[model samples]
Target: VKSLEDFYDMEGFRDKEFDKDDKGTWVVSSKIAIQKDDSSPLVSKNIYLFFNKNNNKATGKFVLSKIYEDFSKNTENEYRIAYSNNKIELLDNAPKEVELFLKDYKFLVEEKSFKSLNNLPKISSRHNDNLPLYSINYLIKQDNEINKWLQQKYKFMKQDAIMNIENSGELSNSSLSNFYFKVRYKGKKEEIQYFRESINFKPSKGGY
Candidate 1:
């Protein structure tokens, strides 16, 4: 876990770049997903690794961090830590509460992709809502945890779903097709409509 060999041998590392120090300022760069949070709804977090001039350890590491409340969400932020002069400093302006948690992340090399089962959405519960629902838009009505997990899973499955939509014939839902719904939001009745044909529906990218 302490040597460059251990790092290079780890699994599920997608892309990589390298450079040598004394010869050309040694560096190794790659991308990986690491579960660096427990309290956060996010489980699979993107991490960018950069190791320059030091092979035994990395010189720069960044984590895709999140800040969310109620239904509003943000994951664009990144928590960065860089190694310099034999010391590592948390460089990103993460919230004070999250800043301290970064200190406990995987400091050593990981042999596998970090997966957080606790945070993963239970598919059964997610799709079992009494109210009729379609993909992302319907998810917003769900609670915070389900909302976060739905957005996360949708981000991964959107392309496939789009392909299905493209190949499939006749998009119709009983509730949507029949146009029979007495659904209300916040005690106010809402009107529902359905179109005979379909258009490429792209859910709001990410932030749900």
Candidate 2:
């Protein structure tokens, strides 16, 4: 495997503007004007793709960062579709495990077969911090209800519950947007358009 320093010193990326993060991941940064036409006060984005070098292979499993500036409300969001093992992993500015778990959970609940899990997709974000302290009783009631529901389901529900505890958390709008972008980008890329049509890609909703 080629070391981080060695990979950065290689061709193409030798003089390219990039950074080595604390974890020694190579981050290639770039910016693109996302606005349509020569619109005034143009909106652009700073995109960063993190990679881990292994011999001649580079894994983009690290986060692909997208920072937008002065974006318009009417502008439709676009995302780059990641296929195979090149799928994005960490999302910037959040807990990596939580983000990945939520992303995969969304995929499992929405895209996977109905037999995957009963009532998994119905998980909602109705509970808020503003609730009264006495809500603890209702919270425990909720937990008992969930436990009963799981007990009535598959033998693997225990492990699933454990994994949820370890990896799940409140899904932020930005983190969720990162997942949306990776799965569906309506950009000028021909390959992306091809995949959108071939895969019959459509944006999903209401699976928090």
Candidate 3:
């Protein structure tokens, strides 16, 4: 198995700039500018990829990180179309073991299905905190009832519920909502975008 250190030292990444995190994980990043003509402005993009040495031998996938666009809004974008088909990069010089962890920082969850490789911590593990449980309840409720229940429960918990906890916007509704909760654990906190099929929600609670 190739270690992360070896990967960084590889030819492709040897010249790239990077930094180490507190956990010893490395973030390899780069900035690139492309220009087709002097008349057309240059297009610049920043690419980031995180590399963490796997502590376990089990194969896993990278958890979804930050998403930048609304695929629901730009359904016809050719880029979106390419990603949707997973025709992007299956033949890249990537390791099968690597396919288990650390998603390509350039791609979004909407572009591909990495569900089989996902290895996020369980949200229910921190039941004593009550926040995650409330979050589940919040996600489970139908109609606008989630707001009232969350408001009263949050007060009892002596804490205010924060929406878009991770700025993921995964928990938003068509209308404004007063009830929102943040899921925090082991000093890590974020409103993760749970898979819709994995959640227990009423299929036809409201008019579709």
lDDT (CA) per prediction:
0.31, 0.26, 0.25
TM-score, cand. 2 vs. native: 0.20
The residue-by-residue lDDT of candidate 2 on 1-208, one tens digit each, is 1222333233321112233321123433323233332333334333233333323323322222323344543343334322124234442344554355325321222232223333343322233444211111111122333333333431112212211211122244422111111111123332111000001111111110
TM-score of each: 0.29, 0.20, 0.19
Indicate which candidate wins on lDDT: 1
Please provide the root mean square deviation of candidate 3 (C-alpha atoms, Å): 21.2
Ranking by TM-score: 1, 2, 3
Q: By TM-score, who's the top model here?
A: 1
- Model 2 worst lDDT window (10 residues): 193-202
Better candidate by lDDT, 1 or 2: 1
Off by over 4 Å in 2: 1-23, 34-47, 54-208
In candidate 2 the C-alpha lDDT for residue 20 amounts to 35
RMSD of candidate 1 to true structure, Å? 17.8
CA displacement after TM-score superposition, residue 119 of candidate 3 (Å)? 47
